[model samples]
Target: MMYHHLSDAMLDDYLRDVPVPVGLVARLKQTAVPNDAELDELLRSPPMPDGLVDRLQAAIQDEILDESLRQTKVPEKLLVRLRTIPRARRRSAWRRFAVAASLLVVLFSAYCGSLSALLAAMRPKQNRDTTLTIIELYVDPTHSSLLTMSEADPTTIRFAPPTSAEMAELPIELARLDLTPALGPAGHLLQEVRRGAPLTEDVFLMRRNTLGSPQTNDQALPELSHVRRRQIAGVDLPLAPGYDRAFFLKSGIHPPVFPAAGQPTEAIQVPLVTRTDSVDLTRRLLLEGRTPSPSDIRVEDYIAAVRYGLQASNDQSLVLYATAGPSIFGRQPHHMLHLGVKAPRVQTATSTHMSIVVDVSASMRGDDRIGAVHRAFEIVLRHLGPNDSLSFVAVNHEIVRQVDFLPASGAAQLASMIRDLDPSGGDNLAKGFQAAMSLAFEAEVAAGSARHVVLITDGQAAIGDRDAARMRDLVATGETFSIRSTFLQLDRLISAETVPSSTGLEHASAVSPRQLPWRLVTLATGQSPVVARQARLQVAFNPQAVLAYRLFGRGPTAVTGLADVGVETDLHSGEEASALFELWLRPNGTEDVGWAEVHWTDPATGSPLTTERMSIGRSDIAVSDDETLWPLRAVAIVSEVGQRLSGIGDFELLNGRRFSQRKKPAGWKDVLEQAVGVHPSAGEQSDFQQMVDLIRQLEELALRGPK
Candidate 1:
């Protein structure tokens, strides 16, 4: 075992009372001061380095000399005696002093070792890195409504602004936010304070920008919990509580209302915020009496068109809803009609015979018109059961039989022939119907089966008996042969005048029930009265500001106009038909809107059924207060607005004026704002919001003027 030796300078430092290095002091403190046995063993083990003893002696001497020089109180007698001593005697005294200093230094070194032990025993120990950080969030609902503060982590805090969508679902009127454990040198939470208010466009933008900021820590965001209702400032408020350090609070605000002088005063009830759906939004907007865009208008039209049809029952009778109101411009009255026709039940037969006539004309080449015919054939083929016989005829300038009557087994062959056929030449709708009718008649006589003829055309008759009456007569002739006929128009040109006559054959030409095949008789007898001729609806308006109107929800069916005020459509059993009319009203006029009438022939009695005259007076105009009429009104306004926005110039007087107008109508924004106030269902709220957003965008675009 070897003992470590201390440096001479360190020994001098100990004797002079200079601060010892911490490392040496710790080592000395770790072991007791060297024992005498250890010291003697160390001295005997090795000789000290040359001049080491002298160096130690010199250091001690310097320290002693410095201490003596600082003594100001030297006795005068002792100073005189020291000066009288010889120089040689003084030298000897110095040598003796150096030796004494060396001895004292060695003794002080041992005392230093002992002092280090004492110092270590007195020192306290502690962990320097262990620290606790406290994070807190404080909220006061009474002051801050709709404000939320969250402590995401020890170093991050986030402030969330109230969202419109959220407000729409809350009953609060005001909200404020307050954060506690205020930010300090550690970090900050919110850069700015936000107050609660209606989520306006500007507020929406600010909230969006804030949420997108880089400092926002989405993952650490506190989950907000629903809070119990509380009363603040004498008002009830909704508060949503969140994570340990997050809070959301809101209060309600009631609108002021003034009643007429004669009316009794009543407490006002604020409407609770609720979710909204698409239908609800449209309905609310319309009830508020706002001018709707063309798209909005179309939505109502579509709804009306489909809604009535859904109400149809097995009874073949038609259902109708018609109303009128004051136009936005206040001049002419707006007229509307909702019509539904019940469809005929499907007929089944043991054996079937059919004729499909397709027009392969030049115009049919476009819009995949001919392709539509092919698709129809494919559908027909799939429905045909075993023993069903079918024939295909392609007609343009002339009629050509592509496939003669063949059983369902030949369906693949018929389909092939249809696909191979090409379009050319002028349209001859009359000839096509004639050829199809002739084939259907032959099939009826040969098979004594259920015979039907389906004539597909663009309704552009260019040659060969183009007269509408002649075509109707040909269809009647097929009916006499016990063949039912259906005309499918591929283009918009086909009108009620051109569609085949729906009127059944005269009693004189009718085969007696006794002579008719049992199956045919069974379908016609004891069933709901069949629609003989297609039903016709006549619509007229007052003040004559009507420019044009478009119908929606016909669903692959066609409507032929009898005149501006009337139109005709076919109705089949078990099928629902609906029509939505989009009306263009004239500006700056006033009068009672006109009436509507529906005409149809009862196939069972061969008698006509006409609807009672339904009329609308100026007083009948819809107002926002009527909840029942809101949906209707909304649809109508949306339809009109949509048409206008589309730049449709069909309106006679306003066509040119619309494009050249320098200023938008007054109260436009107010109208939209009022519409926004109406509450809707949740499902439709998003759609309604989108419409509102669109309106705002359009307004902005208009402000920028034409590109």
Candidate 2:
């Protein structure tokens, strides 16, 4: 029988009183002992700190208790042996110190491995690893109240000296980074941060969720969580940027207070915009193992992102759908009214002239923004026919590349052009738009071919035409040539006036990269035609039937008797636009709840076509579980989740001095069980499910103090 050979260390152990096999005995003869010179050199080294072995062993013991450490695949037997090493060896001081130093190195390497695992697990599955520079602020030990910023990755980050306001408390000096040439315009972002702008929440959360220190559990937040933020101040202390009202208001300016009893009729001007960014932002935050900021939750966007089973119209008119159900939300029982409208489908067989302008600026480098633009055009290219013409333009500081009116037959060439896009330099989106419009007019449209310019950008126009007036002018020029402009906003924040006065039926939609292909398909193929231009919905609640009412998604800019505000919204074929209202119903009142009106115009004649109205009745209200009431139930479910995260519309009796918990709303479990949920079964359904689950998990995590 053959015996396995032992290692040198094991052989040393075996030779000390233990019997060794013949195979190990032969290997032991080859092993060498420390020479006289090596022994002297080891002795000459400086003495180790007193209790160094004990401290390291204690640290390892505490590290084992961390959640990250518990989840790691470290060998239990090895850890147990390491813990007992000091007691097992009755050795000299220098030898114990040497052993402990070696163990410290091993522990550090293990920690790095665990940290990489933790970050990888938090990143989205579809995204590649992105390099990010994190700037951390820690309280100085000598001066507990003072904070200091650490040096970030030198290539990507830079800091100017603190401004007078920033140094009010202490200098808080930070090391200035040397920004490389490749960083380009990104270097300005650090100045924005130093000026008290809110830093990206991802950076903040990434640091907050990293592995705990091995030496101590002295974290900034209260309680003793294994995942702790060492850079944060105390519990009541504000963030480093000093969050103000403007910072919170960026989420959205709260709508005017709900109309009081005996008030005039309320009307909301539904703007022509698609609000999907907030939903995308909230989901991305949750996917990264971070609780979304309350301000990031916009209930209106959640309502707009999903479908409500609205069907297409047969004629050139509006199809109105309305439903009423008793709501389970709020301090008092209320009624939920769901108002929906769908525009009739228009078949356009004419060839389309398409112009695609892509932003290849430095700010668009992260988050795969350029990749999304590429994918959008790929979808558009697939939808076009041989006769259809395509124009591709890329912009950064100046026009990077422009291929004018490439026939669909040359799609391979266009694809190659788009794939070569690389993000760099400044953003001059206005120049790109001008070039695209010039190309569109230079080529005469064949008889009835449609003209469309699709501008894909993150909306950070740094160099030129940053104001609304210039963009409005560009939109007007596009209107002259009957060119429809569609701005695909790819950022988390959507400005209210991306293309200010879009009278020429210009459109804007906030969408994620994953959603870009489908959105582009709808635009490129005219799958959903615009049946209504400058359309608006007016819902007047009966004062006798309802004591107070609040409109979800949009709040009335002003409330007067009637016709107070004028807003234009575009209604598309096979697309559903819905508004949810929470009405405080008056007991012992009339049966009539409210009435809604849909006003729209003809797409060709620019004349008002017809008005549609539906009268809501209180007597026909059903419970949420009713199969026929799914549309209204969906509005309730999505609105409630948004309110729970945002704390908006919740009554605060004590005005922020005290807090209390009321009964939670019901039917979430039932909603999940229903076949029809927030998104369809294709790919979005799974994402919606994951988002809901993450919300629940985050709520539980909040309740369980620090773990």
Candidate 3:
């Protein structure tokens, strides 16, 4: 079994033919072979060319299959079936794969193109620039009642016929008194009389004589001769003797002053009088002729007669005090009503549910107006806290709920929507209010939240109910729902022509045409027109050199430099500032009499600051009954007169003649006398007495001629 040195071919043939003894195999098993380093190196080396091993394996497999076939016969039918199978089908599969790959490539290219187009479509479109104009109508709810008149009927009277002799003498009597110098060119003798200047004795005598007699040169006036007196208010009363002269004098006379055919007459300057002044003069003349009945005066006339004193409340609120006096026009009792409103202060911690309803109607399309609204929204958003909830409703002909009631997280989305908004269509304030109310109701349901709806519009409701009463009702509806509503009317200060040239792509430009070089664009556009000057500069300077500046009635101690300081620096919340200027006495010198002012913008609210002025001569202060109360009294007078003349009050009298002889209520002088008799406080009594004395002095001055 372990034959040594046997030839390799002989040992292989002997092992194949006969099995080796078990003892010999065991001995071979136990024997250890030496390590063949050369053989390991040969194995690690490349056996042959890359495909040589595969080729060798295929050849070996074929040889083995051939040997097996030689040793064992295969079925002829199976071998024939295997050989008949088609091999070309593999080429078909390859072709299908190539077609699928080409299809995928085409689909991918199309997909990429479609995706690019979609992205482009999502972008904002650029449109042409549109110019817009806005007009705001502010209806004060508190003052609406003033638009109506009382139900009481006015008294009427009739005069008796006059004789022919009186008519004949009227012309001669009128000619004796020349009214040219007193009436000036405008025929406003009452205005001169109201100025309270002393009149000349001759002028008084002329007026007395002209009003006392109806005959002159032994002839009766024509007015007396043609006596056709009509009854008023169904009351027929006999005329007093010589009533023609009184009537003629009370009713102003117009005498023609003709110019030569070729000669030009010089223009005459006439002093302007406000409606209040006219009413006052008319009332005074009626009193001088006869007493007015109680029903003839109006509530507004009564209110206008009192002088309201200004006082600041403890909480920095304003308190207006009006001295109660009898009606100046009729016999109406007077009472005082004081109202105070709390100022809005910033509260960062409070949770607010705010619904902003903006009018994006055609009227608000103006860049300045709408732009102001946008800025206001920004300011409001900035003031909102994290706990605050917001809802935005934009209205034109239709209502758009741009943002629903949600937390401050939606602020960014709301702002984006606002920027994209462009004014179009008509205003539907009612629909806007409804949408806002819905939001407010939603906000109300949330616990611990205060609801408010801010309506920012041009105040024109064209597509909806434009009636003021209906609008007020809508506001009342909001109140019922427990939602507080505030209205802001956007008023544009600068005209469209004032704006710089605007290209269609102004929106894309870095700066807007509406923007001035020095300040933000919206500051000047959004604020009240009165503060335009201040919004731009943040400061205003006085151009004139005045001896003194006084904020009258506020006292010299209230502000520093009562006389020297001209510029006003403190202006907040768009409040207006007015000052009385003391100028150097320039008797006959010709110089500009106006005061100069500069205004600037407020950084906090983006509103404008305003400075106003009034010139006061030394004589005015000297002639005033109470110098300390002069400014307040003057302000009260202006306010009262303005209120009455605004047409919201005393509608019936607005169109009446300046010197109507119609009877009116007793003068405020009588009312003051009664009030004084009531034994008011010493201060009140003094003020009342001073007012009475002032009125008497005015009457005396009117009767007498100017010195």
Candidate 4:
């Protein structure tokens, strides 16, 4: 078929009432007929039309259908009616051209609505001066607190310290600190405060008594019911000798709602390790024919539970890849942004000295918790190479026994000793931790080895420390010596929160018999070699290009009474982290949508930090069939499952409007098709499908249940 350039006469005929040949519409749809450069240049000009290709395609299809019907024989009445219709006369070329130009203006104006929206969205607004909103993750090593602050808001939100009763709810370490002097009579420490520069939502407060000797201040501080607000320049206090303080305001991980035009930037701190206890619990509940509580489902854990097979950076720099696509869970105009980050891979030169604390308390006997520990140890033994050393400490209401560090050659003896362990009596966890720390401290100093203390328990008893201060001192002493610790809960029979959070532990996990091996392996690999410490990923969306955005999973919500947030999340060698965001792009916006950056302290240097960044633009958008998008597809599927199970209804952005609604059956079908058919089953895709199926069954049962 021959195709020609769209001439002025052709455009005039199409714009006018004059009937044009059916072939003209088809020719316009041809790629060779219209010069893309010419069309794009025209679109770039003022009053240029958008969606020209779509309009042409639609017009061509309609004309083809009309011509096919015209080929068929018509009834006598229809033929007579057609003949009776008025025959329009063709106008002169100049007159026709004049009319076509007017019509073209109207069409261009219609398309420019989207263009105007794009420009308006990008235009700077009054009072919102910053082009970037960076939420940096700050970890105070001295106070052991993880602080995430948004550098967008100037207003400082202040809340009074926890009262006497509220203080009891604080972690053991923080609860023991005497703050009466600092808080004063009405907790009015920072009076006559003033607002300074813009600050992010500061979400944590941590304090420590740095004095060599304890100070006796018997002043009483009254309890207040409500939180007092003050626009303070910063967290400042006239401190007594040897007392240090830090404070920040708090907010949920994702705000209840957001407007694209109002808050175009969305960010979250990427988790270094995968957490699966919540995912495991939800699956267990479904298997037992019971619905899991919404609170029990952590979206971050679910998504993290599925390994995306992302590789680590080969060099010292962090690796970051970002891409966006049409959202599957959300309606039209909503897009999903996927970010995959990897820390640099580091090689370990020294061996690790591990102090394994076992809780042989009778409570562990109920679920064969001891057996789970044995299985976990078996996996640990496999990962322990010739350079590694291990020790065992038993605790039952008190310290039962302690075994000094043994080389990897003693694995057989260690396994034998572990198998011989028996559950009895209760547990004094504080004492157990002390003994394990002592062993680790000794080993670290003697051999200059990596010191790690692993505590395995059923989390059924409290440390027999009435003062609380003593236990805090003990844990702080271990931290002072740079002893790393991890808590492994043998069972979740009790609330997982009961496990001590103030013990300076890197991570706490509940292990089932089936998950014991995998969890241990994950832990082992995660502890392989330290690559980056205090690592954080920050993404800033271009307000002009991106209208609004929201993130999936609880990225960084504040937990009251907790000093640190994700303090234990250090990037291990070859570990990958992922995040998903729902984005609404401005129509006809610039290709420069946003950018991502990662900052972390290099473990080797430990002084000056390192940073790497990548630009996200229109070209970064990927189609469903793109093989490189599997990780993102996997993240999306896992995140959707989490949102559905958690009862946080799916977020939808239609046109420019945003809302939340329960996902429909069709939505699930689309997710399942992508998960099973399109996305590769490289990681936990199969298990994810099972989770999807289970959620469907539960939904079906829910609809059949009482309202």
Candidate 5:
């Protein structure tokens, strides 16, 4: 019998099959890779082909082939063949068919045997392939006296590092990584090395719940069971540029911080990297403290941007790479985070006052910005109390329309004007805000109430008699007149006021709560006292090798140990904020493992906010097989697959590629349903289902990827 066979790898890559994550299944020309193992076997099996088979799916075609067909006169032909064949020959023919099936099985597995089964055999009989890492991080209270408050004031991470002797003594199994001090304000981020097949992998943050508490046989944060294939806007980043001392700056900034003890603190220049235009990168980062620019770059572009783009443009000077590698966020908080106002902070029906300036510019015709704006308006309208008055303006060159939702005198006229606000010649947002200020002033005059001017724009501008100073003057005067001018900034604008029409971070806005909705976020969350305003972390141990740590929180800036920051400043408004900090610890040796102290202090207040200490005990915490499915592993895999297949980078990363996350899947809605155990809102059940789908997708990807 003739048999056809193929390897799992060949079938996976060439057959248009990719390993995809579980839940997200939208194949928008940009998503791929994830199918089950047993299911994969069916996919790999060769089938008899026919005209009907060519048109239908493999499974359906199989069913059609298996079904009896034609006039049922099969016995006559079978009887003739049976008579021709000797009884012994007939039995022999059956053995030949069995042998052929065995041959096909061997051929299929010649190269693509099961990875799990092979690894299972190599492992010690008593040992499970999976393992978990648990670390007790703490500091020696007496160590404080050893360093002295003055001596310990960190100018750099190099002043001291964790030692090795104590590390070797820990009771838990651990994978150690190199530790280094961070420069300037950001504190040390702890990184750890995890062994993997494709490359030497590592983790930056760790679990807070597992550290320094009771140990129920504490486990290491899960490792990635397998590598993921991600496509981020189809951009590929080269390793050398980021790790091999390269700097690419499409844009950057220079800040001045003085030195201590008569020492001159040299100016440090930081570069911004991007595949999109430098201006877009700069503007987005400066305003939102995020890489809001679409990631349309190749890994190579990332390398080049890090290497040559960062140098002084004219000189092609290579900037210095910091001790640690690239930040989780490439460029620091220097971009616009606000995509736009996502509705007013409150939709309560309380008596309130608000104003909105819409971007009805001809340019806004088909962008998502308009839809987003409509969404914001809807959310804000929900919070307007009976006593509150909300106003609206559709701006194009000038105030195209205005709606007074309160006074009841001009509501209908305003609505008609709004409906008729067709996209027009240009955007004059400054003028729109001025008019809004005038209206607010008039409203305040008419009735005593809190006055606020909410300016909405793409942050773009078309001049008609205005400048920054002029705009600032209006804002200042309006504020002095007791009217608060809150900017619902949408996009960044470039004009003669900008440098050579260059779009870079050089001229970013220096405002708190950089974007619009954030203002509401701060206001709303501030009402809750439990919302953390400041935190302090104190860590200690081997004071030799470097240690770097980062806190995953929302805000414009990261609080580093070097910065003498007080934790008095409040975080944006929210009932609670949660983050999982991954730490890569590089213990000099097992001997160096011991207790590390972490004290979290606020930036606004020097006093300690949280004084948490964890003591680590070392055992045999080796990286395990279970990590192959950690949620983030799935995310990274999905990212690679998406990027490789389609260039969907911009909003996908921010939205997490629609993969339902466990910790904070979407927002409060998710938190209430999961952690708080509240019933899901109507669509939330679907969200959880989506997460399950993603998990299945991940398993598929793992099974399908090349060994």
Candidate 6:
């Protein structure tokens, strides 16, 4: 029962401590005081703890027939609940009446909420002007495992409980481009560079390329600069991060943008901005939930697909995280990286053209390994325009011509090369890579383009003990030629090929142990840096359950010893990027969980930067799965939590199933719908109404299919 609305005199008396349970008096205090007769009657005697109010209400009910309750009896349990209230007295009929009245009031409030459209119709009209706020972030792709949710009405929001039909699936619906676009120039709107802000309140200023059209090679994108200030989905868009903005943008025009892969938003061109001005430490309002705090609307964010293990052992202890650094409005990096740390000096006599050499050994002939390489090579060729050139070669028992450091051609020739690949032979990874590097160096000298070598291999060099030395030789060659070597592994079957891989992994830490063999070809030939540089992350935490936490393998990644801490991800050799870490915290003594900070470097120039801080308090909830989600987070959480609870081993989730958004709800649908229903409509009809609406929707819901 609400105590604040009680009669002022009675409330003051209750706070002052007159022993509770004065039935008539308590009822008089909790209910509206009738006229002079009622007032005089209450003054005659202190009300008893029972009977009086019920009798009075019953008498009123008997006299007035219009508003009789179908079930008017008040139970002891409700009255008992009221007794502990600081302002409430002991259990009594009077307390029961008060409880009944409170319930009635709540029903009426809900009734009002259901008629929001009618109330809105009666209220003054909005300016009809809609402003779109743009947001963006950087992401590392090697280690990330994000999936995209295609259904659940990105256009119109519905008020319903999350059902099995609404859950999102993994690996299948997991579109890396859906949230944060893969490393391409198309999402440049959110991919613009960011400079750090002092990050106190609404003080940080986010700036971008502010384009009106697509940006292409050597050409600046068109610009539309007047900032529009309208709240999207109950969230205010100002110059602010994810909260309310300071000004109103011109009305009626929709912001241009699209929900980036692994990011938020669906509009095109015009960027979307979020609420929080910058990062925060103490607040737990960053991620989404049914009950949002002021801080939740202030930032735009989503949970990461991969759950880091507690102490890097098990994936339990999920933490909620908010958008910060470059990840807020754009795609961010999946893995934490640092490059050029101890890069040897290059004594190049001339600038070299970019080139990559691949290994088409027998080990990679099967299972589309060669196919993946061909696809990557094709994408890279397309990425290059007039002024650029590349040279490609395939190494087997003998070096074979793929592109041969020649100028790229129209799509036809590239396709023929890709389709002609035939893989089979003894593994000679070292020679293949060496020949590729030498060819890349020679191509650079001939064409005057940046030089690089990409090595794709499934096994270590077949030379046994000399394998390590051979790999080292490849790295040294890249250094000597001022070219960077990007090593990509296809399948994990090469675990036995130890020496060559170990040496290469040590030098090219950015390489992924599980990428398709083709990606290596792209990396070696691509111009973007292989890793981000000079990155840092700072996290402020809710003093609740966060007694201590540790970052695994990453340097000093633990925060237990320090009062406050900042984390960083850096080292860029290819294109620039950042990442978001959702840290669901379990507060002490309270099931309410909170999250930590995720920050990174400016992709343009490795510089320290922070994102709008997001914190989600503890929760003891076990969300039911949504069939529509196809077990995205549901599976992620299950795997992480299962590993945590069972102390089992870690495994990568691979999706062999695909579900359509139009398909009937079954598994993932149940997961997503459950989360969607947890959050009240709050009268939000559009996803953009509250920029955090969708993220909140995601936070409230998680889905995983049968293991």
lDDT string for model 4 (619-704, tens) is 77764445346666677777877776666665554332333344444234555556665444553433455556655765655656
Residue 601's lDDT within candidate 3 is: 46
**Could you give me the TM-score of model 2 versus the true structure?**
0.41
Off by over 4 Å in 3: 1-345, 444-448, 463-473, 493-707
Per-candidate local distance difference test: 0.45, 0.59, 0.39, 0.59, 0.35, 0.38
> What does candidate 1's lDDT look like per residue over 119-226, in tens digits?
999998542322223333474433333433223222322322322334222223334667677666223323322344333345554565544332222212221222
Local accuracy of candidate 2 as per-residue lDDT tens digits, 145-261: 323332332233222333323422223335788886754444665666678875444465346553332122222222121221111100111122211223223433332223334
Better of 3 and 4 by TM-score: 4
Give the Å shift of residue 697 in candidate 6.
33
Order the candidates by lDDT, highest first: 2, 4, 1, 3, 6, 5
Assess every candidate by TM-score. Answer: 0.25, 0.41, 0.24, 0.42, 0.28, 0.29
In candidate 1, where is summed lDDT lowest over 10 consecutive residues? 242-251
Segments of candidate 4 deviating more than 4 angstroms? 1-274, 344-530, 555-569, 625-628, 654-674, 681-707
Residue runs of model 1 more than 4 Å from their true location after superposition: 1-311, 321-351, 361-363, 366-447, 451-642, 645-707
**Lowest lDDT 10-residue stretch of candidate 5:** 335-344
Q: What TM-score does model 4 achieve against the real structure? A: 0.42
Compared with the true structure, the alpha-carbon lDDT of candidate 3 equals 0.39
lDDT of model 5 at residue 400? 74
lDDT of 4 at 569: 50
Say which prediction, candidate 5 or candidate 6, comes out ahead on lDDT. 6
